[model samples]
Target: MAGEVPAAAAAASATLLALELAWSPSTLTDADIEVLVVQGLLLEKAISGWRSYFGEASPSEDWTATVVFRSFYEKGFGLPSGAFFWGLLHYYGLEATHLKPNSITQIATFIHLCKGFLGIAPHFNLWRALYHLRAYPSKGTPDVVGGAAFSLHRGGKYPEAIFKDSNKRWAEEWFVVANPTPGLLPRTGLPPVVNARWEEKPTEEEMVEVQVLLAELQKHKAEKLTGATVALSFAKWLTQPI
Candidate 1:
């Protein structure tokens, strides 16, 4: 009887903890939102010419440019690859402020930021986060007391299950080498490691691309960009080429 009582108490405690976590508000701050907005805008500008050069109307589907364009589109904005995403964060000096790749809660928060602040389409990473969290949209009961329009029920077990899986490949996908060259590494099937560093430094070409983006932003400072703010001046100064 004593064992049964202790077991029941433990289960109740766990349930309370889960509920507490579920109802907790997001941890992102104003500065985090500003950083995300700037990063999204820069990435959008970096790929602006791709559509005209290698989009659906391109002469040949078999060409590498066409393939690259389609791949980036499929991946969504600011996520051509995990390495690219990491590089952009690093280039913007957001390495310390950005969410950790291995954290399910942080990833979910980032997705929410992208959707709510950037007003952009969700990518595979969002889908993956949802799947791993076993989350599903909930439509509230109509005309009932305390009813709401909609909500999401994020599953409890899957978040922990991801860490326990013998194959840690999924977690590995969230990280990359500090200085990665695009197309140099395969996207998946990396050997799992106990500790992974999430920060990444941009390549020379990426640095130049970012410099061009800042220059363009400077030229068009008078024009308003969606989701952009004066915070960008700080980012430009931080990323100025040495």
Candidate 2:
């Protein structure tokens, strides 16, 4: 029974990874996909074992969110927070007005989407202030925050129409063009700046905000369900109109 449990969990993890990769914005090679599957399986086993050992007294939601956000901040290397935020908003057709701090479940959903799907660290405090969640501002643009690894080109260069029609191919092309030492630069040229803050660390304010958000989520939970149930609730909440 114990051995079968591990095998079943591994199979489930692989299935989930496959489903997620199908919707990934960037195309991944077979080798990369295999690597992700292996990693996902390992993560699943570790988390499952840890939860089993803890049993009814698992870590608090705030602790889990903090660790997850901090790990992403430490490891993420591609897109900066602002660029990822821009892409997330554009892809989801979400405006700044939709991101309310008090909407704990929705906010948690966005955090998960930003990290899991967008492959970027969620800058909680920055986003909250940018969207004026807690009396920050009525309207603010992501461009003003800076630290972007690349920016969308202006004018007819890399027109929105091209990307709109191109699908994932455009994402692939952007990566190829964005390469610092591409053999041949596109007609639009490379991104103007490449401030890849690989060593950047999370600020105290950001960690505090994460704690606050998780605490709110904890309060919103009506029962003592597993993290998976909470995650499912967040996912369902995402489908409803704002």
Candidate 3:
């Protein structure tokens, strides 16, 4: 009888601790959010330990803590990080099977982050990050969410068709479709018909659109790009003569 009472008291203590640790996004401080992430990791580790220590329980699917932490991270931070979601998936013991909704969301957020919120162009680093998210997926990769990883990453809200569009691939397809040779300069001395686009300038609306895009990207998705890539790709092209 005494032992039963002690067990009940332990249960009560656990309940109280859980309630205390519970998170409400509105009340979360940076420090508290950090704590929540750590605690979520600890729970994941606990499940791992149980599997290793006793082999008495199946792999843990106790994603309660992970789910809670993700809710906080997504709401408080407003931008999703692949690493963060991967941590949550680990906590849930779900190996990110298939083109899971979260996987699509993370990759889309990744591209959107790189585009300064324009949501175009596939940056290698962004692709690398997505690769990392899917790296050790539990059940191997199920079919991609949509045809492209990024669109599906955003809960199918985005359509990735543009990425593969022949027109959008103009920069590359230009060489194949419309090769601009020196136009056979000959004794006839006709000027070469260089089909280059020469634009005048922009208006206030264009300027505002650009500025707003930049600001929105920074606010919702962290932009971590610079011109270094352009120079690097250019340098490589120069060396390779491509």
Position 129, candidate 2: lDDT:
28
Task: Kindly provide the TM-score of model 2 when superposed on the true structure, using C-alpha atoms.
Answer: 0.21
The sequence of per-residue lDDT tens digits that candidate 2 reaches over residues 35-100 is 422543112223321111111211122212210111121122111124444444343333322222
Give one digit per residue, the lDDT tens place, for model 3 in 1-242: 87999999999898655533321222323343345336442223233221121211111223221122222222121212244444433332232222233343344344444443445553432232123322222223222111112222232222222222222211111000011122111111111111111111234555554454445444433344322332233234322111
RMSD of 3: 25.0
Instruction: Evaluate model 2: give its lDDT.
Output: 0.30
Model 2 residue 36 CA deviation in Å: 25
Per-residue CA lDDT of candidate 1, range 126-228, in tens? 3232232211122221111111111122641111212112322221122111222342222211112111122123446555544543344344443543212
Highest lDDT, which number?
2
Q: Which ten residues in a row have the lowest lDDT in candidate 3?
A: 170-179
Candidate that scores best on TM-score:
2
lDDT against the true structure, per candidate, is: 0.29, 0.30, 0.29
Superposition error at 237 for model 2 (Å): 7.5
